[model samples]
Target: MGMAVVTLKKGEGRLLKSGGMWIFDNEIDTVMGNFENGDIVLVHDFDGYPMGRGFINTNSKITVRLMTRDENVDINEELLEKRVRDAWEYRKKVVDTGCCRLIFAEADFLPGIVVDKFSDVLVVQSLALGIDRFKETIVKLLRKVLAEDGITIRGVYERSDVKVRKQEGMEMVKGFIGPEFPTLVQIEENGVKYEVDVKDGQKTGFFLDQKYNRLAIQKLCKNAKVLDCFTHTGSFALNAGIAGAASVTGVDASQLAVDQATANATLNGLSDNVKFICEDVFELLPELEEKGEKFDVVILDPPAFTKSRNSIKNAVKGYREINLRAMKLVKDGGFLATCSCSHFMDYELFTKTIGQAAKNVHKRLRQVEYRTQAPDHPILWAADESYYLKFYIFQVCNDR
Candidate 1:
């Protein structure tokens, strides 16, 4: 049988027409010819106008993820190699080559595949059916591309253990891609060192997207007493210590995370000034407030409060509460570096949540700077998911 052809319902390819990479099941008018799921198929408008070719999965709500918009382009080894090469070249220009996100799913034109480089190790999370089929090929191509730059990846670890994999009918899995090497790898960013645990850590072991954001915090931390909440591996806290902060306190609910963060602090010779506390930030914040604790800089880098729209109300409450409590802990004229890592929390809503928090605390915020994830995770204009992280620096003015 010839390749299956998908015809869009009359006026249903609006997203595809607008350069978006998704074709929902409801958008299709008909599936002509015989094809297996995950097979590459041609896309056409209801009037037979060629749209492009993509992989279709009846199991996914995203029925089709466009691979190539060019009718002449073929999804062959040559095309895949070029895509991987282009992604690597882009990272070299936009981020630190030592550690960065090489391919960011749809943003890099490779839908649903994320590859992060940590020192000479690569960690991958393949999140979609179409990309899953090509995952091994992409990994091989990525290694080949990096080898050209004198970067020999020692090992690759798969961390596709997230529940989202189930949505695509994939089994959650984690293991070494090939011969196992020590899962722990060391790398330096902005003059600070870290031991990233690629085998088992949050979201591919390290948050390379915040490389510059941590650096940005350094300039404001000199001689300041700092508090870094949700300090996973103490990245920001260590940065504060390296910047000559008087003292830095890093808090997390996970003892494992706190231990790792503490070890990372020692790795950077920052142990003298940086301390990690294993405690729920929600509970710790109230106790600190009760103690009349104050810090010259309070950094709130919490995990995503909500990943779905249904929990947005609860997420907003979480954001507002932590930010308000954090505001009270900041000394007058001190700084607040806050951020949200949930795409569901849009910029407008997040900013408004913070504004309401400040208002609730009767505090005036003197804005300093607004930022987002590093350029390594380039945000595509039409793919809003790439733009999830929102960061803001402000002077918390409590003139009570």
Candidate 2:
């Protein structure tokens, strides 16, 4: 007959009512019309009050991802173009567009898709089945939007290889979306250079969210000895070196990442002062402590300790252990920059974990500054998952 309608159970859709984008499968009461899993359907409350419109995926626990709050709106080319243009415009104003996240999924009102710009290349990640159908259209629109500003997109790549795709009943796949170009895309940020491997690198090649966070440590690193743990691709360590750190040692367990970080250091002409070491940070931290090694500044940019809530307890312990060891390695009055990239590790819990670490090591922390992800990764207030990066800089002081 007409478009399918989805009705939410009574007292459900609480997250959607509060400006969030997801409607869980359990929250839906009934389906009124036949539709495919990825079809756009009308959604209403238990009493038939129209809620909004979203694409439905029965296979996903997050059944509906609302595309709009307006009952009259249609999902079409015009709407997609507007979304693409709005995301690009916002990035041009708030962050360095040379290399940054152009669209942060639900945060940009385009749920289940993320697009990143690295110089002349664009990387697209489609996480939901509903959005996968429109992925190509969004990419074309984005290319056209950037072209209007005289920016030529030489290549477009799809990195939809994340495990979450399986949750949505889709295959994890990655390859060139159009004409094949070199997968190794070189770009610059904060006066440092990097080669991003879109075909293989983690999470769309690089972490653009830490852009300004890397810049934040420059002044403090000048002429100081620095340690960068979990230094993926050497973003922080290279930033320290470029800022004239006397010496910078970057550590990561991945040999590929270490090699990439080493190449990046050479690209920035900081090879002599900046070095990459392939070692497990946990084991190395305690070894450094035993050796009585100290640094003027220590940076801990670990990968997400917990991807799900089920593992949060262990994540807290991991965070506490690393922070405690890093604190012990920091000279008195030295700077310690730490962060948690997992949304499961919320701000309050992460802060408390770090506090516990400092106390366990008998060290006091003088708060210097607190920051979230760069504006390009805007934290939508009600969408807590969009606000993952929690960064804090502190002065670690030994008890007198």
Best by lDDT: 2
lDDT of 2: 0.95
Using alpha carbons, what is the TM-score of model 1? 0.98
* Per-model TM-score versus the true fold: 0.98, 0.99
Model 1 C-alpha lDDT per residue in residues 1-400, reported as the tens digit of each score: 6778999999898878877889998998899999877789999999999999999888888999999898779898899999999999898888888889999998999998999989899999998888888989999999898888788889999999999888777789999888899999998999999999998889899999888999999999999999999999999999999999999999999999999999999988888899999999999999999999999999999999999999999999999999999999999999999999999999999999999999999999999999999998999887777899999999999756
Once fitted onto the true fold, the runs of candidate 1 whose alpha carbons sit more than 4 angstroms away are: none
For TM-score, the strongest prediction is 2
Quote the RMSD, in angstroms, for model 1.
Answer: 1.0
Lowest lDDT block of 10, candidate 2: 378-387
lDDT of 1 at 81: 97
Per-residue lDDT for 240 in model 1? 95
lDDT of 2 by residue, 95-195 (tens): 99999999999999999999999999999999998888999999999989999999999999999999999999999999999999999999999999999
